[model samples]
Structure formats: C-alpha cells, structure tokens
Target chain A: MQIQSISLSDSLILTLLTLVIYQSAAWAQQKSKFIWLNPLLVTIIVLIPFLLLSKIPYANYRLSTHFLNALLEPAIVALGYPLYLQLQHIKRNWKLLVAILVLGVILVVTLSFSLTMLLIHQKEIAIALSLKSVTTPVGIIITEQLQGDSSITPFAIIIAGFAGGLLGPSWLRFLKIRSDIAAGLSIGAASHVIGSMIISKDNPYQGAYSSVALIICAVLTAFIMPLLMPILSVFFA
Target chain B: MKDIIYTVLTITLCLVLGKLINFSVSGLPASLYGMIIYCLLLQLGLVKPIKVHKTNQWAIKHMGVCFIPAAVGVINHFELIQNHGLTIIGIIFFTTFALLTFVAVLAEKYLANKSESSPSTSNC
Candidate 1:
C-alpha cells in the first residue's frame, strides 16, 4: 500500500510537470506552425498519449483538473466587462444582432444534426452532435435534456470550435464577407467559447460581439432545442 | 475594496438567481439561466456596473484556465474520436462555413440598409 501510494504521488507530480511544460512550450511557440493549435490542444495531444501509454483512467486526470473547470463561471462573468465596453455598439445593432444570431444558431444546429443523422444513422450520436456548436456547458445540459449518449457533446464542441477557428475567416474572405461584426459574431455564435477565444486574439471588436452573441444564442438554444428535438427526431429517420 | 465587494455581491446574486432558476425550470440549464439574468440585470441597470480593478483585470486575463476541466474531458472518450473523427471534423467544417456565409450576408444587407436610411454614422 505504501509503495502504491508513493507511485501515485510520483505520477501525479509528473502529470503536473508535463502539463506546465507543454503549456509553456505551446505559448512560446505561438508564432510557429504550432500556432494552429492552442494550449488546450497541446495539452490534449500530450494527455491522450500519456493516458493511453500509462493506462491511467481519465477519471483520475479529471479529478486532478476539476478545480480548473470551476474557473469557467468566473471567466464567463469577466466577459461582462468587455460586453460592457461594447454595449453601445451592441445596443445600436441589437435588433439585427438578435435576428442574425438566432437564425445562425437555428440553421447551424439544425443542419449539422440532420447531416450527421443522414450520414451516421445513430440517433443518440446525432442528438449529441446537434448541440456541438453551442458552448460546452450548455451543450452538456442540452444533451442531458435530450437524453443523448453521455460522451459526445464535449468532443463535439471542441471539434466545432477548431473548425470554426480554422475555416470561419477564410470562408468569409472567400465570399467577400467583410463585415467584421457579422463574421465574428457568426463564427463565435456557431463555435461558442473556442471560436470566441480565437476571435479575441485576432480582433477585439469581433471577439466582443461574437462572445456576447455566442452566450446569448447558447442560452436561447438551451431553452428552445429540447422543444424541437422530438419533432426533429422524425427527420433523422 | 468597494469594487471587489460589489463584484462579489453581483456574482453571488447572479449565481443565486441561476440556482433558483435551475430549481424552477426542470428543463433549462442553470448557466444559461444565470447568464440571461445577468444580461438582463445589466441591461436594466438593476445590477449597476462596478469599476474594474487590477485584481479583476488579472482574473480576466487568465480566465482561459477555467476551460482546463472541459479540455481534460476529451481524454475520457478516446474511443469515440478514434471511430467518428472524420464525421465530427466534417460537421464542424461544413456548419461553420455555411453559417458564417449566411451571417455575413445578413449583416451586410442590414448594415447597408441602416446606413442608407440613417444618413449619419456612415463611416461604420
């Protein structure tokens, strides 16, 4: 028992060291080809292999990082400051912002799920995929409400964010979509927190609008998505 | 001191309202409830803005750490990704492009009409 406890302690310390090392490396190499990936991306890449190699159960790693997750609430509250700064612009365009964001949310969620179901033919998986574009917390809630299989939402949100960050701006450029507000808000809204973070780095105004739009749409979708699920389920068939 | 106190109070109220709404609505998520209430309170001036201090700025600066738990979550479901990776990636790509296109067009039309009608703030 003593030896096992010592080994666990050693592994735990090593995991923390690994996390810190990779995180700093990712940050330092921010200008390199590694720029395409963020710290979380780096951590995940390192972690998955470590977990698989050591055969450490994920629940253990999650237990170690649970404190970090608690930070999301305060982080979201901090977003209020930026939103406060941009309140004037948001107010001026409130109607258009609402319409566009809601339409974008509905269209993106609906179409993505439909396509997945047609392609994958798995009802539970499709339900999980539908909430992917929303923020992770809200996606988890929506997936639970819909009784989806438990594992899909988080992965879905991550992929959704990565996709949005990589393709969103290029798509806009391709189509000559020049309105920063619209481009940012739509990508952020569709991708949620991941996309919001990407926008924050590239353009503050787009980041601000997108962050607000994403949060608003996420809340709106949570309340509304469940209502449509039963009806929408028919289409999946 | 005053700013910290006020910020704490506001967040406490926000969380309390969130929990209350969660209890009240069996169907809705608590975070959404808290966020919507927070937005409404701010909009209505019911929750007056507290001045941001250095500590607040620091907290905001490192807010990305909050997602570590969620990021760590990806580790739990390795098998799913190994199997459905391509489909998931495809969905993210197509949905993002399609939605971005739609929003950009709508925004352009909206901005154009607003500029033409208002006759002021044309620089935007």
Candidate 2:
C-alpha cells in the first residue's frame, strides 16, 4: 500500500500537524459545551479538506500519520488500566453484563442488516452496516471478511460513534435509564470509544463499563458476524 | 526517566505477548488481546500499576487523537457516501438508537431489580 515513500521531514511535519489540530479541537471541546466539536471528527474534517486542497494523496497523509496509528494498539492496551480499576464492579455483574452484550450485539447487527438490505438492497453496504457498532479496526476487518465494502466501514463507524456520542446520554436520561452501568454499556456497545470517551467525562464508572462493553462487543462481533452474515443473507433473500 | 522506561517495557511486553497469541488465534486483534493480558497481569500482580500509571493515563485520555488518521481515510470513499449517504445515515441512526434503547432499558431494569433485591451491591 506504500505506493510512494514520504520523506522523513514530511512525515514528521504531518505528524506534528495532526497533533496540533487534534489538541486544538480537544481544547475547543473542553472549553465549549458543544458536542459537534469532537476532536476526532474535527481532526478528520480539517485534515481531509486540507489534504485534498493541497493535492496530497490520502496515501501520503496516512503514511505521514502512521505514528499516530501505531499508537492505537498501545492506546487500546491503556484501556486495560481503567478496566482493571473497575474489575470488582465488572466481576459482580459479569453474568448480567455478558447477557446484555450478547443480546445487544445480536439486536444491533440484525437491525442494521435488515434495515440496509430492505432499503438499499446492497449486500456490501448491508454487511458494513451490520458491523458498524464495533471499534473501527475490528469493524473494517470483519467487513472485509464478510466481503463488504471495507471503505465504507470506517465512515459508518464514525457516524455511529458521532450519533452515540451526541445523543446517547440525553436519550438515556429522557428514558430515565439512570444506571451508570446501563448507560455505559449501551453507549459503549453501540458507539465504541467515542461514546465511551464522552461519557467518561461525566462519570468514570460509566466510562469503565463502556470500555468493557467496547472490548466485548468487538470480540463478539468479530466471531459472530462471519457466522451470522450468511444466515442473515438467506433470511433477507 | 526510570518510570517512563518501566512503563514502556511493561506495555511492550503485553503487546508482544498479545501479538504472539494473535499469531495463533486468527480473528481478534492483538491489541484486544494485549488489553486483556494487561488486565490479567494487573489482576495477578505481575505488573505493578504504579509503573505504568502515568503512560496509561495519558494514552487513555488522548486516545481520540490516535483515531484521526483512520477516520480521515473515509475521504477516499466520497462516492460511496454520495451514492447512499442518506440511506446509510438513516440506517445507522435508526439502528444505533434502537440498540441504545434496547440495551439501556433492559440493563436498567435488571440493575434496578438487582439493587432492590440486594441493596449492598448498588454502588451507583
């Protein structure tokens, strides 16, 4: 995939550029009471257009920003610290949490797949939509495995994340779902890290549950999607 | 300086172990494995939390920044979004909201009942 090698200086500059933009967006989010000024969303919006206008290929941008991407794995590992902190809470409710997560995965995949197939009738997009609730890397990988349009997978994931981050807390509140575990699990299961991050600011306990949900949903979707897609396809047809 | 090195080594060890497991098991991400492994290590007292505390905190706090590159990759698929943007958005919105409601309602009911039955277990 490395079609053209980016120079060392260019890569460094791009890396620094991403950090600056991301930090600024994060700062904006911190100062303002708006949800749309999400750091990840803002960074993507600003960088995409900047790259396009500058006639820079997406490949170059990706290559330049590879350092940030490399940190993703460690960032994921970092999540374990919070999960560890919440171990007692998780242990107490493992059975219930597992039951909810498994059910949530089935519910999300079925709803998304059926809706996409019913409306668009495109198998690839349907497959991508079914896995959008999981983290981006897992979703993309599963989408590819299911013969979906992998390119659309990330976009779908971001939209799902944004939707969950923006509306999840308020929606849950309106419904009077006051349990931190419930809020965290639902948001984490449906929105992944984005929702988890947003909720964590309000309550760390909710964030921990959200991260737990994120990990479990990712694993469940990876294993279940491959087996379930064929069955869903048959049912849809 | 010593703390930073210790943190790096601990995380790297987990990542390497995760990668090794991933080599054998072909589905889940190595990072996911690393997360579980890291948690287990903490549980077993194999890795001291204080050693990795600073790094882990910083990483988790700013984790959103790491995802920007991949999200921007979406730009490559403008045609896909242009073609089915509304339908796709609708499906995502509907399904996400439905799942959120379903999970939250069910979980909330179960949790409330549990707390009522055993008040001691109710932390929040």
Candidate 3:
C-alpha cells in the first residue's frame, strides 16, 4: 500500500488558492454591495464548484489553509482595539448602553434559540442557531461547546448577518425608527461585524453603537450559553 | 513597519496570556481572555492606541475575507443541510429580523424619551 504525502509548501499553495478565491469572489460582489450576496456566501458558492471540478478534498483544502485558520483566533483577540476606541461613547451613555445591550443580548439569543428549536426540532442545531448573531470566532466556539455541527455555524452566522444587514435598514425606515444608537445597536445584535460595516458607512454613530453591541452580545452569549446548556439538558431530559 | 511589529507582538502577548488563562480555567475561550487582556493593556497605558492603529484597521478591513474558508466546512456537511436546511435558514432569518425590529424599536423609544427629558450634555 502506498501513502500519499503532502508538504508544508503544498499546503501553503492550497491556502493561497483558497485566499485568492475568497478575495476574487468578494471583489466581484463589491460593486453590488447586496447583503445576501456577501463575500462569505460568494466564497462558499465559488469555492465548492472549484473544489469539485479540481477533484480536491475539502479536508485537504482546510488543512492547506491551516495558517488562516490559526489567524482567526488572533484576529478575535484584536477586537479589543475597536472596543477600546469606542469605550468613550459607551462610558458617556453608560446607563443607556448597558440597558440596551443587556436587553438586546437577551432578546436576540432567546428569540433565535426558541425560534430555531421550535422550527428545526434538532437539539444540537437549535443550540448552534442560537449563536448565529455573534461574530464567526465566537459563534464557532459556542457551537462546538454546545455539541452542534461546527461546520454549519459560519453559514448560519452569514445568514443572520445578511438578514440584519440587508433588511434591517429598510425595516427601520418602515417603522420610523430614527435613532442612530437604537438602529446601530439592533443591527449589531442581529448581525455583528458585517452589519456594523454597513451601518458605519452611512453613520458613524450607528457604527460605533453597533460595534459595542457586538462586544456585549458576544460576551453575554459566551457566558449565557455555557450556563444555559446544563439547565437546558435537565429540562430536555 | 513599527506599527505592524507592535501590533503583532501585542496580539501575540495577549493571545498567549489568554491561552494561559484558558489552560487554568478550562471554561472560558482563549480569544476572549486575550481580548480582555488586550483591553486592559490599552487602558493601563502600557500600549499606545496609536502604535497599533494601522494594523488594527488593516486587520479589521480584511476580517470578513479571513472567515470564508471556515465557512467552507459546510461543504462537508451537505447531508446535514439537506435534512434541516429550510427550517434552519428560515428560523435564522425570521428570528433575526424579529430581533432587529425589537431592539431598534425599543432602543429608539428609550433614547427618544431620554433626549426629551434632558438637554443633551455630550454629543455621544
């Protein structure tokens, strides 16, 4: 029997190919700026076909991009910078910020969890869906800890992000909701980073509010899910 | 170049701190621990915000692109998707919209009333 061997350089090449595909797909959609047509969706759309046509295994592809995979953790650590920059605003409206953020986290997590659980009927997946509104790194960690399918967590996150990023602004207009802090906080709670970028481009206040929302929401969800799991297991039992 | 190295070293130090904390606690995620440590270092004035500004902007700008490969894991779970695809996507979409509406309306109302009750002191 012969075993196939691959080298670090080979993995590096594969990683570059994956990165290029991601970048190109994102660039192609940069003109449209449609929320649903986001770069994440585009990357998956384009990458899958290319993998099939090229006869490359998904595991092999993931291993090739192991470098980028490790980079994500540090990237998450870097979130501290944004939060630091925005800390002043948060301090200014500490009361309002705390009130809105705590409320937003509870509403988003509970609503997403119950809705997904009721609709899907899969316990693990319901758990995964609850983490949909968080940033990818946090979402992935929560999903894995809850024993959900980690593979689907990113796709779930993208879907939620597009939902809030695309439809949220329109919905705000339709509802006559005009406060920047409110709108920004809502989008961040529902979508996280992508939605923050969308809101930030038009209004910096909204973006700032949204960015803080991500921090609070992520931190709250992190602790909430772990504690909730044990309680939930007893109930499900 | 200074900014790049400073940011890289800062991140490395914070992430290492986070990893050590995680190793001891075994419950909290390391990145989050790193994030908190990063924030503390900044707040304590040990690391100047200006030092890492450029690298932070660059990383944040390209952050979305980095996560694309992670999503590709979905390709391996086609069977799972086929089983629960529509309901799952539907739930996520509907619930997300509901959440957005709820938060926006509530926050708007709160902020509006606050502004009406008092003249603004700070722009923020």
TM-score of each: 0.78, 0.84, 0.89
- Model 1, A1-237: lDDT tens per residue? 011323556546755655585567556656564444656556666667876798666666555555565555554554454444445455666777687777877787788778888877777777778877776656765676677854567667777787777677787787787766666667777777677767667776667666666666776677668777777787755
Which pairs clash (backbone N, Cα, C closer than 3 Å) in model 2?
Answer: none
- Badly placed stretches (over 4 Å) of model 2 are A117-124, A135-154, A169-181, A196-212, A226-237, B116-124
Candidate with top TM-score is 3
Compose the digit string of candidate 1's lDDT tens values, residues B1-124. Answer: 8877777667667767777877986566555556566656777777665554344556655554454555555665567678877877787678767777777788766853453111111000
Candidate 3: segments with Cα more than 4 A from true spot: A1-5, A29-37, B113-124
- Of candidate 3 chain A, the 10-residue stretch with the lowest lDDT total is A1-10
Instruction: Give per-residue CA lDDT, model 3, range A133-206, as digits (tens).
Output: 88887887668766886677888888888778877899989999987778887898888877887777788777
Candidate 1: where are CA atoms >4 Å away? A1-34, A70-87, A144-151, A192-208, B46-48, B52-61, B113-124
RMSD of 1: 5.2
- lDDT of model 1, residue A1: 9
